[model samples]
Target: MSKLGESLRALRTRGFTPVAARSAARSFKGVLACKKGEISVKLTIYDWNFLSYPHIQVLERQDFLPELMPHVDVAGNLCYFAPGSVTLDRYNPATAILQCLDQATAILDRISLDPHYRVEDIQNEFPAHWEYGQLSLPWQVLLGEIKPNTIKASYFILEIGDKKQALISNTPGEATRLAGALGANFKPSHFQCWILRTKSLPAVPQKMPTTIKELFDWIKIWDHDLYGKVQNILSQRDYLKQSYMPFAIETPVGWLGFGFDLDRIRREAYSRDPKKYRQYLHMKGGSQGLFRMAIKEVSARFVHSRNLSYEDLQNKRVTVVGCGAIGSFVAQALVRLGAGTGERGILKIIDSDKLGPENLGRHALGFPSLFRHKTEALQEELLRQFPHGKIIGIASSAFEYKQLFDADLIIDATGEEAVSELLNGLRLARSSEVPVLHIWIRGNGEAVQALWTDSTGGACYRCLTIPDPNHHRKERFELLKNAPVLRTDGCRAFTPYAVSSPLHASALAIDMICSWLQGSPSPKFRTRSVEGADLYKLRNHDPSKLKSCPACDPT
Candidate 1:
């Protein structure tokens, strides 16, 4: 089952009723699909209040549930309209209409199967998302569901010029009390009409208003009900009434705030139970840590799953040739994305050069690590970030390296002709079955070439690029060193004028890695660049295949 499906089933296993679970799952699925690049009907949020980015982020983390609260102003600013506040402007017709349509659909779906189903009280769940001033007087299905004995109403505060109007009906005395509770600023003149519904009305009932005070009284009742529901949900979940410490060092980025006391959490977790503490740090956002404290938190829920485990890299050895710009980025991604709670795989780094300022724009090495040899610098950085992994560094040229054939996978980032020739020669010499990913970061930095070879009938570099046949007979060593380079013909320099190309290259390389992991479509073998745009070949393209090509010809 898909992760989402599994999660839905888990929810069902929890206390949620089948109807509630399925209902929530359907809505959550719609939201999840949207997040995963699916398109849907554009939702126009009305003149309701808006939440802060951090709060919105929390919603995103919690799975995008609909919220009910104050409406957003027309300017998209969240408005906390005071009680008994008056406004002649109505909800924006477009957004309010859309919301009503959606609510209507959900209501119909609820009742279509069971005609007797009651529209439960519509609780104002979260803050609103409406534009205030721009929207005119328009009405919407204020509340959705119904339950026995009572019907919930949506209250709207109308503002007109300097005067305010409160619309809703309950009783005159109660309305007067509500207006008085709003403070001295509340004026009777600012008040307008109201809508009141009794038990005798149909579900699609009509609104009957007898007086302004009654409407104001009904508004107060509905507002209080909405607030109660919100509190109920929060209380049920035992969510910390306050947000997580903004400066909590638990999050990777939390260090940006008041500075997290990582040592504190570390010490706390360790002193109690060492193994669990280690798992706490690696469980993602400290879920295990929470469990240690006996707190039922849900921050790091999905980060410790098997699908995300380093199954591909576990117990497998890989060599990353050339600790340069492209090489460092690829290595970092692999380390972070592949390493599990306790890393075990070995990642070997081979490069002879040291870090230089000229390479800073592209290289992952920091300014502090300048002048350090590439292999040593990369190894240190990797070890520092991923203390659990084993990183090996070889500070020597490819040809001089003796252990070239021992690795399981060889990733070639060395943009030198000698390295490629050495790999090809090593494969031929040892009859090595190691798969090689020969990656070439184009000079323009807009694209990268990955020549994947399994040497077991899968495509090899020789099949893609033809080496001169005649030169292999006599001065093979000399010809290999002087072979035609990739930089000469298709090479384009990434001038300082166009620096964004490196970023593009980084993203493409990461995408390739993800695609490879997902077993989806891989990138083209050789991608051509035009004015910095990348294009790839779908099928194998053999430009140098002769009727009797020596290397790839069938025996």
Candidate 2:
């Protein structure tokens, strides 16, 4: 016997018996007859490969639990281990199997004794449980708010080219904004929907309710509030029709949908009396159809707030002074950080230069943008992918448009001395009206540095360039020994930084922006060195302002 097969022999004393498993080579299985107090469950250890988690399932086909059982699935599969949460000892396969068996039974024992834990566990993952219903749609997205008791729902049509996708949300106005962003003409949908949100969920069923009557029974037992509301709506006079009622439940996790049609259309011929209409709506036969649906949440609230931990730049007005290699990435990253995605948000780009074939090697834009103004091309490219951003492109100089400088934050990626000094003067000119973030590449991609200037008396952009006693404005803490060698293709000259330089600068800016949003943006300046670069000794501490310098220092 293999070392793992010998491990199975230990379970015999614990009422487990070995079983032949043709479940691929080097796999194992055994039926575990475990009894916790009065409750007994026969589970089988199915798949135990080095590649996957040990698949343990209840042995009897009829003993499978409901979808809402805590840590246990519909097929009686027990989830003992969360993937990537722990490192399994692949070296000791024998011990690993024994450990998994113990953990699986421990979960079973706890849920068997404590019913409240099972309720909370199911409610926490309610969306997943509700989706397993046989008649549910694949998924849905929302763009509207949901409140308890009231019914607010509608059907929307979204056309992405020739492919038309119909979906449901709470309001037509919010849905109109989302669908209109794709440049499609808006029209009302014929497929009407009704959404009823409830404060609590229904109790776990013996099996997922397949009939409308079974669902009503489950709701009556667990949720008195939802049951009361559903009763009042269905009891309305003369509103009874044979048409199917398509509706969704706005739960905490997400929306879950189910629909049922009335048999009155077929049965109405049997009865001409008004009292017979109520009798025709009864669900006595299995032929009374009941199916579930999916409500995919494509709403700004869910779509934008789901995965983010830090505050996104949703409603902030941001202006990019350059749309070159570094600024292109900065604009793209800012959009992803939720800039220009809110109702009052704005993302403006200003650059006088046009994109060339040579700029593509180190730029965020590509061949499609050749010869087009960099600001306009970046706007075109970004809007094609993320139409939610309110992007304005100006194919002109940043200095000429004085009103363009008005922003919540200005990102200067032009990397020019004249521009930095002018921006510093503007901060002083406007009494630090708005913060400016200047990010640039230095010494041929040796490092990328960024400085965030937000205070009136704090370190201005010119503080880094203040002249020393030797009459030369040098690095306060130098990291580079030699300057970047300027490269020329005979017509114009430019520094030949690699493609990775702007990306590094973008990463640095993103971290600084996070700190800025957190309201404690200390260590205002930051730098990152490229690995394996033959550079001088690094001096990367945050530098304060000079006391007697020219631009920012008091005279």
Candidate 3:
């Protein structure tokens, strides 16, 4: 006997009888019946493979109370497992099949007992079965370019008597002209219109509706009176004819065009119960029928880009002193985190050096940007990736940038003691201090550190470095206290480290900046390195603000 045959025999022992069976190598089909319900269940199992798991589905619909159970869709397909959760063990097909059957039976039994369960009971799994409204629109309508911010516009309805689909036009003039072209009988003034404005992109719905009433319920949750308002607007038009309400939803994924038709809904209600036709007519806000709405999803890149963090980052102005390895990565990371190119936030990159062949392996910019000034190249690269990001690249040293004093936050990635001292002096001299973050990699990428100081009088970058008579200025970390320096043939000595080391340092710097932006208390100094790899076995370090710092005047 085949493995399926043995499984069927086991199921029979558990009070399940096979009404019909099909034996094949490629697939298995059987009609099963159980004492749980008088309904005949057809199970079709596809062959197991790496790409597709071995799973069975009920082909024939069963008589079960709807909307009372989790994992069941409107089509009656029971979701045995969530996607990517687990793979079926083809070797243990019988055990897997029995386990699934047991689970399904338990779920059905629960539904039979409690058909009116709370919707919140299945909140976690609600999104898996959510059904979005059908929306259809022409490509040209969505392709039309508009401004970034919100704008008020009119939605013109184009539906006649009792039609299932309602056409809508965003262009009011085109809608009116089309009405005129149709002839004198079609009065352009009589057409339904809505005054709508672009709203911030909403999150993709987690819990969608399977029934029209469920759709209306979901809409009510978004705006309590919106359903009633939409109904009232539909009522103003001829009830006998198909009327449409314009719904333009800006979601994180894209723009969605939705149409709500009242006439078709009423017709559906009359079809479902002829005796309730009078009741349907007398119902307020057209709540008697299915609240089905059409949605047209348009693919737009920027739709999903605006959120709370993105909005906050948009309002910030940041300056990075060095557009080299660490600075370039930090700048790019900031842009990806919602720092836009213009009014949203300004990202000013300052560096006097040019991108050379030596920098390509460690730097964010590549061959295309070689020989170009580091700031300009990085800015151009960032703009190419994030078109909306407001980035300014200044090919000058941080000392020449006087606007740094006025910035919301300044970052120094120069890895130079002279530059840190200059910024420290400038910060102390100013009455209103701008927050500064200093990031650098130590001991040939074995260690990475980030120091942050804000207007609230935290330890400045100079405080983190003690005046060293032996080696000039040295980090407080014991590992770097007496570290040897490598000499090169030329004036410039190469720092031996991988690309990942600078990136790691950049991430730490970004974390500090984000914490300050969110109004959270962050550590003044932090460091991370691999233990016992290249230097000291210390894995992490977090130093407190210095009490005796000349730069911050901590007496």
Candidate 4:
């Protein structure tokens, strides 16, 4: 007998009996008794090496109060272990299997008997219940706040692409625009959908409703407000006779949707189609079935801020004033944070430099961008990666464009003391409310520092520096034990730093941006130092204006 088989034998006393192999699947069927009584269990060795989890399932889906069970998928697979929650002992497969089975039964028992636990589990894992499995479609999602006071159903476009996947959208002209941007082909046909929103979760039930009758019944039982809204929308004469009726309902976790082909219900060939329905008495359904459209939310807002407590930059006008090593990372992070997605959202990159062979060693752009204008190449790269992102490149000096300063926020990643001073001079000259976030790496990737300043009055960029007769650049807080080494390749002098520094600098900048978005932008300046570095101590707190600074006065 194999080790897995021998292990199954040890559980015989607990009512496990070896089941004959059906195809490649090996399993032991057993019974586990809890406060809610006994439920059937099947433990299968999914991986002989025990590198992956064992497939544990509850076989008694119909019997033993299945309606109240939580964390059970459509196929009765028990979700006992969340990935990264526990690591399996690869050396001892027998003990690891035992531990997993013990936890599975314990979790199953707890949810089976405890109503409060079941409710919480069901609410937290709502999407699993609505799982569409292999048929899941690529759909655009927006968790854009739907005001509670707004009682009417909103208009949304459902487009089916050439590959037969669908996208749900509220953006005007989004279908054609997105299709072109994504390089996807689509037909002329599209569906109109009305998705009912709710701030509640569905109660644990005997499988997420596989039919239309059960869908309404399930919603009516758990979310009364949403149920009433659905009925009100259904009662409207304008919506009754549509040949194809597609609808959706939102739970707190995510959204699920489907469509009913009202014309197909009468056809015997289409009689068994899950999405076939008949409209009788307008609000009444003479024939009803279920076809689930599992939504995959790909909207910039959802991608960036789904389940996040703080706001994202989806609607913000952001400008990154450099395309050097640090700025490239910042621009990419900004895109992911939704900097250039919404109607008013615009992300502009400004730089005069061209991508050279030397810059590619540590910069985001590689061989493809060689000799291209930094701004134009970066713009192309960002757009290619996120086709929906709105980005503009100004291949010019930061000092030339007055419009560059007019943004919700500006980030300076030049890491040049001269540019910082120039920006500080600009800051002193203007009373604009827009804040400037400055981030840079210090001395051979030893540490990263970020400073956020605005007209609200605190430290400006010049405050961090003083005259350094010994050095070419102004001395700032003396961060390194040894001076940063200057490199020259038969050309102009520049500081040499690795890629990691700029990446860390980018992360620091994003953190500051997040803080600003969160509305309490404190600790305006922060520092993060790497280990084994020749570094001086640094403080992470808002700084007061330097009295000796010449640029702060702007005279």
Top candidate by lDDT: 4
- lDDT per residue for candidate 4 within 182-296, as digits (tens), equals 6666555434567677777766665566556776778788888877776666555444334566676677787776655554434333344322322341335533665666666
- Give the worst 10-residue stretch by lDDT in candidate 3: 136-145
Supply the global lDDT for candidate 2: 0.70
Sorting all predicted structures by TM-score, with the top scorer first, yields: 4, 2, 3, 1
**Model 4 lowest lDDT segment of ten:** 274-283
Candidate 3 lDDT over residue span 1-555, tens digit each:
486677667566655544344464333344434345633343445563323443444555445544334555555566655576667666666776666666565655555555344243354333232332122222222212233453324433444454223334444443444344333122333343343332332222343443345555665665545556544544443333435334444433344444444556664555544334334434553443333333332111232244435334665788889988898899888887656433456888899999988888999888999999998889887766655556889998778877877677788988776787788778777755677788888877777887776667656777776666796565555556445456564788876678998898888887876677677636667778755645654444345556566676557
> Per-residue CA lDDT of candidate 2, range 1-555, in tens?
475655566555455655565554333345443454322344344444445666676544323323457666665667877886656676665677677778776776666657787778777776676765334443343335443454645666677677665567555665666676666555776555666776666566655777766777777886788877666655543234435556677765667777776455543443344334434444454236566665566654455556777677888999989898889999898887877777788899999999998889988999988999999899988777666678999988888886866789998888887887788777777675688888888889889888888764466777776476786777665667777799888898888878899999988887888788887555678778888876666544456777765766668
Q: How close is candidate 2 to the true structure, as a TM-score?
A: 0.79
Per-residue error (Å), model 1, residue 540: 5.6
In model 2, which runs have C-alpha deviations exceeding 4 angstroms? 1-29, 37-51, 59-68, 90-99, 133-151, 157-166, 170-188, 198-202, 235-242, 262-289, 468-471, 530-545, 548-554
Off by over 4 Å in 3: 1-26, 31-56, 67-77, 87-118, 121-224, 232-245, 248-257, 260-312, 341-344, 468-471, 481-491, 534-555
Whole-model lDDT values for every prediction: 0.42, 0.70, 0.58, 0.74
Evaluated against the true structure, the overall lDDT of model 3 is 0.58
CA RMSD per model (angstroms): 23.1, 5.1, 9.6, 4.8
Question: In model 4, what lDDT does residue 511 have?
Answer: 88
The clash number for model 1 is: 38
TM-score of each: 0.42, 0.79, 0.66, 0.85
Cα deviation of 446 in candidate 1 (Å)? 5.1
